[model samples]
Target: MSAAAIESPVPESVLKVEKQNKGTVDALYKGLSDGGDMGKVAKLIASDLEWWFHGPPRCQHMMRMLTGESSHTKFRFEPRCIEVVGDCVIAEGWEGAQVYWVHVWTLKDNVITQFREYFNTWLTVKDISPHGCEIRHENHNHTLWRSHPGDLFKRSLPGLILGI
Candidate 1:
C-alpha cells in the first residue's frame, strides 16, 4: 500500500468505494512501514475483524505485528502487485520468478473486515459459508501431492529456499 492508492479528485462512479477502501489499506501499510502509530490504522479495521492463516502456526510474527505486540521498530512490505477485485484487495508478492506470499484482504465501508494469509505456496480462496463451516480439516495434508515415493529424488534435490 502507498499514499498513491487514492486519487485527490475522487471520481463519482461505482469504483468510488473501491478507491476509498484501497486508500485505507494503503494508509495502513504506510503507517506500518513508517513506524508510525498503528492505532490510527486500527480505525480502518472493523471491530469484528476476521483473520485466518493457511499454513502452520509459524505466522505468529505477523499476528504480533497486527496486534501491536512486536518489538521490531520498522516493517516493510514490497508488493509486486496490488489490485482491487470486488470487495477485496489482492496483493501478490514476489522476487524474480518465485512468489513468496499472497494477501487477500476483504474490506467493507473502507474498513478491513477480513484477512487471509498464504505463505510460501499458491493461495486458494475457499468459500466457507456460515452454514457449512463445520467441516473439520484435521486430516488435511500439506505435502501429500509432493511427497509421494516417486518424488523422493525431487525432494532431495538441492534448492535455494527463500521466505518472506
Candidate 2:
C-alpha cells in the first residue's frame, strides 16, 4: 500500500473533543444571536482571554455590541462555517456575504483561552496529522470599512481634500 493509504487518521477521541469544542462555540454564538446574555459568554471564555484584531480600531464596530457599549448595535454575527482542528475552533462569520470575520478560538479545559479575529479576510484551518498545520487563502470583496481601513481612508480622501 502507498504511504498515503498507510497514514493513520486522527484519533476518535481527538475528533470528539474537537466536535465538543465546536458545539460550545456554536452555543455561544446562538446565545449572542438570541440576546441571551454576555455574562454567560464571559464564563465560557478564559479570564485572560487574548483577542487579536486586524485593521483600524474604528472599523471594529462589533466591539461596541460585545462590550455593551452600544444598545443600537444592528449588525448580527453568524458563523458561515466552523471547523475544529487541533485544539482550536475556527469560525468564519458573515453578514449576507458582504462582510466577513474569522474568529479563532484556542481552548484549554473547555474554556476559551485565546481568540483571534481576522476581519475582512478569508480564513481556513487545516489538520496535518502527525505533522503541523497549513493555511490557505481565497478572494474576498466588501465595502470600505468592511474591506479594509486603508480602503476607508482612500474613499474619504476626496472629501478630505475638498473639505466638504
lDDT (Cα, tens digit) per residue for candidate 2, span 1-164: 88844546667777777778998888778767777478776678777777777645755655666677754246676776776655777776555434556677788778888877766664433332333332111222211111222223323211110000
TM-scores for all predictions: 0.61, 0.67
Task: Show the lowest summed lDDT stretch of 10 residues, model 1.
Answer: 142-151
Per-residue lDDT of 78 in model 1: 56
RMSD, each candidate, Å?
12.9, 9.8
Model 2 Cα shift for residue 98 (angstroms): 3.8
| Winning candidate number (TM-score) | 2
lDDT by residue (11-77, candidate 1, tens digit) is 3553787778777777776766666557887787888889877655664444568787774353345
